[model samples]
Target: MAEPKNEEFLDDIEDAEAQAYAEEMEEIDDEALELDQLRAERDQLRDRFMRALADAENARKRSDRDRREAENYGGSKLSRDMLPVYDNMKRAIETITDEQKEANSALIEGIELTMRELLSVFKKHGIEIIAPEVGDRFDPQHHQAMFEAPVPGTKAGDIIQVAAEGFMLHDRLLRPAQVGVSSTPAS
Candidate 1:
């Protein structure tokens, strides 16, 4: 009877030890799973942070480019509006006869001075005239052909006449020169 009782006690001790070991393994597995979840959360946060940083950088660059363009082209509209005034002034000067200039010398001088000042202002602001001479090669970029005519001693595409001069605002064409182009020489 004492031996049976001792055997039963030892079996009970063995069962208790096995149950404790199983519990420890379950705790370890739970800790490992929690660690994996934390690592995945950290990776997702890092990816979002990188994407947000890139978007902010791109927006900043775009704003800088827009500011530069606005500074350069802000006066385009006003400049375009003032071109007709320049044209009228030039026409007035051209139409004046020598007799008219002599009779109204003082008035003519004042007009000439005003024209010179206006031209000075235009030059300071990067406005320039595109005046092509007769016999020059016709350039489609600066000259607009109003008419084409066959002429003696002139090659095709030669500038035979300039009806109106062109103007440029910086590198851009404010107006194209109105011109007559020569066709093939008459047979």
Candidate 2:
């Protein structure tokens, strides 16, 4: 009877030990699952932050490009309006002949000085004249065809005459040179 009682007590101790070990294992498994969930949440947040940063950088670059363009081309409208004044000055100078200059030396000199000053101002503002000479190849980008004519010794698409000179503000054309293009082949 004593031996059986001792055996029963030992069996009860073993059962208690097994149950405690199983409960400990369940707690460990729950902790590991919670750790994995936290890692996934952290990765998602990091991805969102990276995307937002890229968007901000792109917006900044776009704004800088817009500002530069505005700075470079802001005076285009005013420059365009002043072109007719320059044209009139040039025409006045062209109409004066040697006889006229000799007859009115003082007046001619004053007109010449004023024209020079205007041209200097134009140069300072990055304004350039697009003057295509006769016999030169006609470029549509800088020249506008006012008329086409057949002329001897000129190939088709050659510049026959320039009716009015064009103006350019930097690389942008304020006005295209009005020209007559040759329609006949070279004789």
Model 2: residues with Cα > 4 Å off, grouped in runs:
1-26, 97-114, 185-187
lDDT of 1: 0.90
Q: Per-residue lDDT tens digits of candidate 1, residues 99-185?
A: 999899999999989999988987887778899999999999999999999999999999999998888888888889999999997
RMSD of 2: 3.4
lDDT computed for candidate 2: 0.89
Stretches off by above 4 angstroms in model 1 are 1-32
Among residues 3 or more apart in sequence or in different chains, the pairs in candidate 2 whose N, CA or C atoms overlap within 3 Å are none
What TM-score would each prediction reach against the true structure?
A: 0.76, 0.76
lDDT of each: 0.90, 0.89
Our tally of clashes for model 1 stands at: 0
**lDDT (10s digit) by residue, model 2, range 1-187:** 9988899998888888888888888889898898899999999999999999999999999999889767666788988888888888889989999999999999999998988898898788788999899988999899999999899888899999999999888889999999999997645
